[model samples]
Target: MSEPQTEQGKSAMSEIQIPEMTGKVLACVDDSVYAEAVCDYAAWTAGRMNTQLSLLHVLDKNEGTTAQNLSGSLGLGAQENLMQELAELDQQRSKLEMEKGKLMLQAAMLRVEEKGIVNAESRQRHGELVDTLIELEPETRILVVGKRGADTESAHGHIGSHLESIIRALHKPILIAQQSFAPPKQIMIAYDGSATMRKGIHIAAASPFGRGIPHHVVMVGADTDVARAQLQEATDVMTKAGFEVTGAIIPGDADIALAEYQERENIDLMVMGAYGHSRIRQLILGSTTTAMIKRTKISLLVLR
Candidate 1:
């Protein structure tokens, strides 16, 4: 993941290399088609990294006050009976869904096991999704989430609705899985002149994602000597660190250009800051951290 030079068409220096990662990976699942896809993708990735896989399912109870309102709308006696029925039904449904999800996860675990991944395990919890995921062993290398969760029906929707809060709360790297993907042999790293981006370059230089993969470093802004200098500094850092960096200086709306670069390059993943320029606006719009969850179709590593 070393940064390279482009102004004079010179190549960046290469540095020491590390072995491929085979650490613990967490894959969040629910009773949805997307969950199944995520598990499959996770298994494939985990197998490649030679890492253990943890299949996590968080049973969220905050579906809102719809059930409460329905219970109270009925007469006192009838309300009690209706509430009881609804509660039982909800529990039953959740149980059934969990059962199906577990079966799906087990199937994925078996696939990974075939590849000699011996530490495959599964866990189910009845609590908030974000809180539960963070509770997992902090040594977990990556958290793999789907681009859209089971609750989303539109392309622009946030599948993992809690992603914003989770990104802000957790200090780890996140990989947002797109609809369908082969292993990302080519990844695009969005390099803005920010401390977060600095850390991102370091991570790319050191993490499993950047190992043996092509990394493209892109700076989105109006072309100018100042912009070039800023990007050059980043490129220098990465180049010194022994990363294979590709340089780009593009012009357009920031978000739009980013998304476009991802598509144009056929990028499989995007690593960038979650709450830099969009921090204030993001908190109000559930934050820029979460907005990316709704907008992109590639895996994202939101560094804090």
Candidate 2:
């Protein structure tokens, strides 16, 4: 009888364990201003999920590939000899670059650990950023990146170039970091009643991610009866799950209304669906997901 009771306790413990999220949250870090925020959010997520964290920095050589142009003039044989020597010098330079990458990883790890994320790890590699993410996809539960990366210019009038591609590629949620870190107390949802947006709501309410945190579901429209009905229906779902819920219809366009609501209500984090339209379609019609992300400075928890 004692053995059976002991077994029942173990079974109950197993039953209560977190079901989703198979791996660590991998945050792609670079020297850009966004990297620190990425680390901060990664630590927060890892703490929330009771999971591990991994920080990765890719050299991304393809973006700025260039060949050496040796300056000094020399006789033909001497030039060939110098080229060989330069080849050796290039090898040394590559080694140094790898060392620098390691140093960056070490520093990022310290930042995370200092933030109380004890299970954090770091990786340094040389490859296309997208390719590196694809290779590491199997071991990743979530992906985190900056809205604007180091090459922020190329992404003018849009989300980060790498960010757009990564969202399109990954099946997991992506957290877009802002300039600084603040542990979010209130999460505002850009609910459109789409399957993906609903999934984001369910994840926040059911999973360990936002337990006890307040939620506000904001739908953008002209404030008609139909809009209020839709907002109430979604709010009911979250409320039934025991999340403190606030449902409202904000008047304006999607991007503008969301920005105003977040500002007015002091929303700490924004959650919404992503990439619902085709690239060609967005090019002609404009993407609300991209536009909204670009407008806000707070962290966004984007769902697919």
Residues 24-114, model 1: lDDT tens digits: 7888876555665577677766775667788887767654323566655778899888888878877777777667767866776775566
Model 1 alpha-carbon miss at residue 37, Å: 3.7
**What's the CA RMSD of model 2 in angstroms?**
9.6
Clashing residue pairs in all predictions, respectively, total 12, 0
1-304: candidate 2 lDDT, tens digit per residue: 0011233432332233333767889998887788888888999898988888999989866433333665576777877888788777767777777777788788889999999988788888788898889899889988889888877834544577788788878888889988789999899988875556655666666777877889999987766665565566678768888999999876678888899899999999999888776689889988788888888868898887
- Candidate 1, run of 10 with poorest lDDT: 9-18
lDDT, residue 221, candidate 1: 74
- Model 2 residue runs over 4 Å out of place are 1-19, 63-65, 68-86, 153-158
lDDT of each candidate versus the true structure: 0.67, 0.79
Model 1: residue 183 alpha-carbon error in angstroms: 1.4
